[model samples]
Target chain A: MQLISAACWSTYRIFVAYILSLAFGIFYGVSANVSPKREKFMIALLDVLQSVPILGFFPVAIAFFAAVFQGQRIGLELAAIFLIFTSQAWNIAFGVYETIKTLPREFGEVSKAFNFGPDFTVRRVYLPAMIPTIVFNSGVSMANGWYFLMASEIISLGNKQVKLPGLGSTMMSYLAQGNIWGVIASIGTIVLINALLQIFIFRPLVRWSELFQYNATGSAPEWPTVVDVLSGLGRALRIDTFLVSLVSLGNRAYGKVAKYVIYGIGTIVAAAVGYLLYWLFTPPYPWDILVQIPTALTVTAMRVIAAVVISVLLALPFVIRSVRNVQTAQNIYSLASILGSIPAVIFYPPIVALGGRSYMELLSILLLLTGSFWYALFNMSKGAMLLPGVLTEMSQVFNIKGWLYYKNVLIPAILPPLITGALTAWGGAWNASIVAEHVQFGDQVYSIPGIGSLLTEATSNTKALVLTVLCMTVLIVLVNMLFWRPWYSRSAEKYNITE
Target chain B: MALLDIKNLNLTFRENGKELTVLENINFSLNEGEFLCLVGPSGSGKSTILRIVSGILNQYTGEVLYKDQPNPQPNPNVSMVFQSFALIPWLTVQENIELVLEARGINPRQRVRTALKYIDMVGLDSFEDAYPRELSGGMKQRVGIARALAVEPEILLMDEPFSALDVLTAADLREQVVNLWQEKKLPLKSVLMVTHNMEEAVFLADRIIVLSARPAHIMGEVSVDLPRPRDSRDKAFEDILDKVYSMILSSRLGK
Candidate 1:
């Protein structure tokens, strides 16, 4: 009964966060793509924010919300939801932005030809076009939410720790008590929830989203027999029809109230920002923490680089095999996704126990690898799938083989996706760094010297925490602007394979 | 003996637990010094035949013989031009041609020389350094032709080479292809092309093999027997076009 309620609480948190993420993603993505001038700023801002690790927001969440609600449970609950929101939102938003940006000009022209009003265009054209991207990203986002579940639910403000009643907190408590059976049970519960979500939600939605794809090739992969049978059962029960009608009814109601809702949200956001800015300016800031940032960032950056390098090396063999065989690609892809959805934090107790204080640094790196490696693996596998049929045929017909094939064809084909994966992996490494560099179990606090540890240490002091997060964000934004942005655009332009 | 022979070719695709027969009993041969066009309606597995012959596809049950031997492997003596002009976007026109040469183990110096020679033949002379994205659709196809010709293959396989181009560009490139084939400036033995356009088939092929719609098989072969610089305005060309059109239409209607 305890496990069931804890699972339900975790599910509730993830569900609410996902809903918020979907709304924010669509609004932000559409607005970014709609205006040319705003696109540059919005995209740039998203890039910076995306690089900021989810844990970086913990301080702000604690200081602002805790103060607003006078340390009430509602405040902490909102903070946890906001933390999960941070993990899930950016990717979905980026997905939406990309889908809107790349939507065939014909769609816009058709809408204009009919003189579609803003509401009509969004309802009939843009939203439907975004469904596939949103659905796919939703799976990734949910996985991320699960990965960060423990950290979000259990917050440390100053000396007092606020623990929410969820699977994450339950597991943490189990680890603290050294209860092996309870830990195993928690892990089992998580896996069950993940599997249920995959079967009931993601699989069906993925099949449904095919209808919204701009040039849907109708070559969707076949689901397993069980999924087919379940979906068939759904159809027989008229569940799909009922859901469609419910969604349509909601859409109609939303359309009528959307203008007022937008205005209301705008005003609230403006007021919050104004108040936050005032609070920010009247501060006794941590000046010493600012000086330590560059050195700490360098240390953290080195670990991130190490993690990304190892991930690429590990992902390469799978990517090469995947490019050669579709079956291998699909199998590896599904297996990796399942493994990736398991939170890296769950292994911390066992890993920490095994490694002990002597091997803490190595263990930290290992944990970082678990968190970040899948981005590289997933993106490279997806890139392999997108290898243009004509290009592959070109290689085969020419008898291009071995090293030569990798150089001229395969490498160039996967470069853009590899870069994209590495960029995300880089961010994931930074996010994982917080939990990795510093770990807490029972009454023991394990520590390492890095930006992650620095941020974790500063959590007791809100001013110091805010300062560390700010400095870290600045460093991340700088790295993205200087290194990743140029690399991404260059490869995307040069290595693009089109049929 | 024919340079390339596809005997009793059949291809079946299994989709969603159902067997879809795309081609059946496709028997054809490419003779030396001949221009043959396999003309059919779209989705008639005409392109699949090109793919099989080129050794990009091999799941089919049949023998594609090169030099009267069962050639399961891609033959070095055979090269293909894609409808989409599948040039590597990153590689310059020169590099694109050289890539295949490099694959064939031609040394660096000879690779450049051969690439340039073909580039000149296709009139893409100074444009060798330009990327595919920089080239016009007609020019991109020229590079495609040049890349195929650079391999100095005895048999050139073109899959709807002009279909993706505008009508005017297609007409212009069609003339160039004919000139290249007729002039015999390269070490060319024969040409096999797959096209859905009946007029394109009549315009290009010395002999046109008409294929029926799906589960496609050779309907009939029409010998052009026409002279060089063949004009579409010519009554002979129209008559051949009309015959090929009726053959395709009659089969489609029959299905």
Candidate 2:
């Protein structure tokens, strides 16, 4: 019955998160599809949401929710779900927006030609086209839920740390007690549940999406049934017919309240920025608190080097193994996924028990390096192998063999994916290192002089001044410009191998 | 003597949990240096016939003979140009042609040289280093033909190779293909092509094999004895086209 209760809670929260995120996604998608002007705003909002880690808002949410729902079970649960909701929301919205915007040109023209009502158009043309995307995003949303589980369950606000009763809290409690078996059990349970859900539900849903699976050749190995079921639902509901009607009605009501809504949003954002700027200017600390600038630079340099070296070493052998033999590679991929889901914090106690705090920090840093590198290498090797068979056959025919194959064929083919994967891995490792360094269990204390540690200390101390500065200056403008800019430009030029 | 012989071929495919025969009791014999065009509407098992002969589709039950012998091996000497052009988009014109050599383990430098010769022959010498994306439809078809010939295959199977091109480009390409066949004395023992275009069949094929509607069989075969470089304006060519067109139309309307 406890298991049933847990399942029920899990299913309800998941469904609520799913539906809310989907509704938001559809609203954003419809607006983007209907109005060209709204597209940029929608995309920008989604970008900001994606870049802002949901955990970053935990402090704000905890403070707000505690005040609002002081004695309610629903309030605490809702607060816990809010972070998960935020984490899952952006991906789902982006997926829907992409689906709607990229619907076949013919469908759009047909809707216009028929002069269908806006409601009819949306119901018939748009929603049906998006079934596969919805299913795909749901799977991704569920995946994102695993990442946010621990953080959502445990929130340290001022002198009090609230622990919510869920898998996340259980893991945290076991880890804090330095109970190795308990930690293992929780991680094992979470992994098992996720694996089962993925295999049974998500995979099947994806498979049922026949419209998207038109030419089922060379589709990346997906658990397909989730998409398949979503498609079946879309068909059963006659959503395509309804979308056509909605589109027609939407066309008629296009400009109504649109300008006022835009202005209202613009005003709020401007006021927030203005307030933040004022706060920044009135800081009590010496502007030399910016000594952390060079400190950050040094940490970044160390992190990148560690990440690159470790990632390459770990990935190289696995990649080679996978390329030479596919089954081994698949096993590695599955194991990596399970490992990837288990948070860096979860590894703290075991490492501390073995090597003490300082050694654990070093070990975590190395693990961080491995985590980043393996992901990139595995993806790169897979991407290279997954290049259209016809292209591969062409390479084979050219007598491009052995080391020459790596140099001329695999290297050129996999370079872009490798770069992108490396960039993603680097981002992931940096984030992990921060949490890994700051959080410790057992008879050890470890600190890494990095942004992650800064984030940890700031949150712990309730240092709003540093938080705001880091969020605005370091996290957004500098990080994107310095780290992600070059990669984004290269991605635009080269990553379109599929087309 | 027949260069290739396919006897009582039966091909079945599953649809909605039931086995549907795509090709049944299909028999054909082709002589050396013969150009046979299999003309049919879409899904007439014309492509299936070619696939079966090429050994890509081994699900069919039948005997396909090569040089009057029971086929013990899949036809390695057969090269096919798919309806989609199937040009490896990442490869350059020269490299695309060189693929056959590389696959067969030819030296790189020599492969490039041999590849360039064919690239020039296809009037794409200037585009040798340019990827398939850079090439026009006709140019890609030229590369396709060159790749097929590079392997020195005994039989060439072209599945609507020119159908995707504009009429002028298709006609121009057809002319070049015929010219190359005449000049090179290439060891193309037989050519089996699937096309819907009546004039294309008449122009290129020695024997035009017409296929019935879906679940297709050979309706009939017409021999075009017109001389080489048969003009589109020529009366004999028009007559052959009209006859094939009427046959196809009647078959579709009602036999």
Candidate 3:
């Protein structure tokens, strides 16, 4: 009964959260693209949102929402759902935005020549163009949600604690009582759910979405898929005709109300922005929180830099191996996806069991590794696969292979994606620190000195929370501007084969 | 009045804040039923002229008049076939043909029938359900032509449509296009095509407009007097090709 209830609650939260993120992502992503003036500002805002750790704001969300709802279960549930939305929303929005930017110039000409209205363009062109990207990132975001869901489920600020009824809480309760079997069962159940989703949902989606794959050319698979069989049956039974009629009716209904609805949404958004600006300027100046920033930042920065360097080194060899063959790349990719679904924090209980005096730092590094290393590996391998046939042919003509191949061809080719992967990896590492820098196993809790844990501790006091957020945002912006910007531009100039 | 007119056309491009003039004082016009070809040295703004006339680009200091009216928006009576085919990959040949009709708010069943008719006309009867990715380059261009024709526009603009296809395929398609126009099955009253191939221009055009190099201007206009299905091997055809080639070659020099 408990297990069923936990599953139900978890499912409910994820369902609501996924819809919210997807809606917000599309709404804001399209809005940003349509209005050219806000494009840069909106893009930058989304970048900051993604980089800001969700768990860092847990205390603020809990405190505010709890007061708003008077400590009701609904308030906690809303908080959990919002946290999940933060995890899933950014990537989807970025994917949508990126797709809009990169659509072929010819697509624009076709739209103009055909004189397609906004509805036709959005439904047939933009939406279809967005499928593979949305699906791929949704997989990534779902994995992201799993990691943060655990932390959000069991929220603690000072002496106050609220534990939502879900697998995360169930696992925590089991861990508190030293039920190793319970942990195993919970993990097993997670693995089972992950596998089932891949089979029923993701695998089919990725395959089905290939209809919208941008100009890929390969012979049709020799074997038929379940979708093929089902579609064939639908055709045979005239079910497709019925479905099309139903859809067109829905499309007509949507078209009728879409304009008024859009205007309504626009007004609300403007008011919200105006209100947020007002709140932002009406600050009491929580100047004291700046004191903790320097110490916590230095430690966290060191950890992130170390983990990123090690992760890149570790993932590089895999990129070479994976790119050598398609089957091998697919296998490696699926493994990463499975591993990604299990948050790095889940490894803490076992790491805590293997006890030592200085194990916390090592454990933090290990946690950081899981959070980051796969991104580089996945990205570089995918990038390597995109190496043009002519470049490879030229390399082969010149007898480029082994370390020489890496030097002459592979490294330069994968440099852009490598940098991109490293950027996201660092972002994930920053988010992971909220749990990595502070670990709880059994009745005992271990804490380390870092910005992640500092923010975690600061959550109890509103003033500290406010200042911590401000200081951290400034630190992140400065690092991005000073460090990553030059590196990105240099690499882009050197390796932009597209031009 | 000419079916289409481009007057005092001048175009410039800004790349990284550097001004580059692409066309200057480009004057041209098309009579009804004329197969007009714009032939110039490579990178001489031939396609740029085509785009301006199509009203796809308006930044140039010029006027493009369609039926003697200044075309502010893209003229619905005109249609274009792009050099790259521009067929959306996810859409099938049938769907691509129907896309324009759908934009015009045609019924679904009528769209299917109309699209199939054009597909047959393009000799792509069996390939209607195939995606653009599934089609060969030559077949893709044929689809491009069919899509343009599907709109039933009065003016058709083709931008180096055959330049990406094989020579034999291009020649075959050129003949078929001429046949389509000669048979009066195509509703288009005028065709304006851009190409660098001298033989292609001489082979198909009623009048070839020769253009100079960068900041392209009208160097000359050569009228082809050859009979129907003008054989490329014939002395008259070779003379025309020679004349156009010399005009383009001299334009490339300090002429």
Model 3 misplacement above 4 A: A220-289, A324-327
- Model 2 residue A417 CA deviation in Å: 4.1
DockQ top scorer: 3
Q: Candidate 1 on B1-255: residue-level lDDT in tens? A: 588888999999999999999999989888999999999989999988887777667699978888898874567777888887766544579987886776666799999899999899889899988767667889989998988888788889898999999999999999988888888877888999999888888888889999998889889888998887889899989998888888888888888
i-RMSD values for every candidate model = 20.9, 19.9, 1.8
Cα lDDT tens digits, model 3, A1-499, are 6766776677677768886877676656665676566687787788788777777766767777888988888888898998888888987888788777778888878887767755667666776788777766777677777766687798774587779998778877777777878877876666676677677666666666656756566542222375677558867986535433433443443464766785698899899867755665576644455576899989988998888888888988888776546455555556666667675586685586576437888778888877887777667766665566667787889888889888878888778878867877887777777677766555566778888778767765666666676666667766766777678769878987551
DockQ, per-model, please? 0.01, 0.02, 0.56
Q: Write the per-residue lDDT of candidate 2 for residues A1-499, one digit (tens) a residue.
A: 3334443455466567766777676766676666676677667666666655455556677777877888366667788788778856776676678667655543443233223335645654566567666765565466556656777777765677777776677767767776778767777666787677656664455454423421224223443555567568977996555555444444544465855776787899899878866776575644433456457546744765587667855676666555534446445544554455555556665665567655754776765664365457545655544455555677678877788877766655666656645654655465455565565555555666665555665553344434533553345435555766566557536744543
Ranking 1 against 3 by DockQ, winner: 3
lDDT of 1 at A431: 88
Give TM-score values for chain A, per-prediction.
0.85, 0.78, 0.84
Task: Report, to 2 decimal places, the DockQ of model 1.
Answer: 0.01
lDDT digits (tens) for residues B84-192 of candidate 3: 9998877889989998899988899999999999999989999998888788999999999999998898888999999999989999999988888788877788889
TM-score of 3: 0.90
Clash count list over all predictions: 0, 54, 0
- Candidate 1: global Cα-lDDT? 0.80
TM-score against native, each model = 0.61, 0.59, 0.90
Looking at model 3, the pairs that clash are none
| Top of the candidates by TM-score | 3
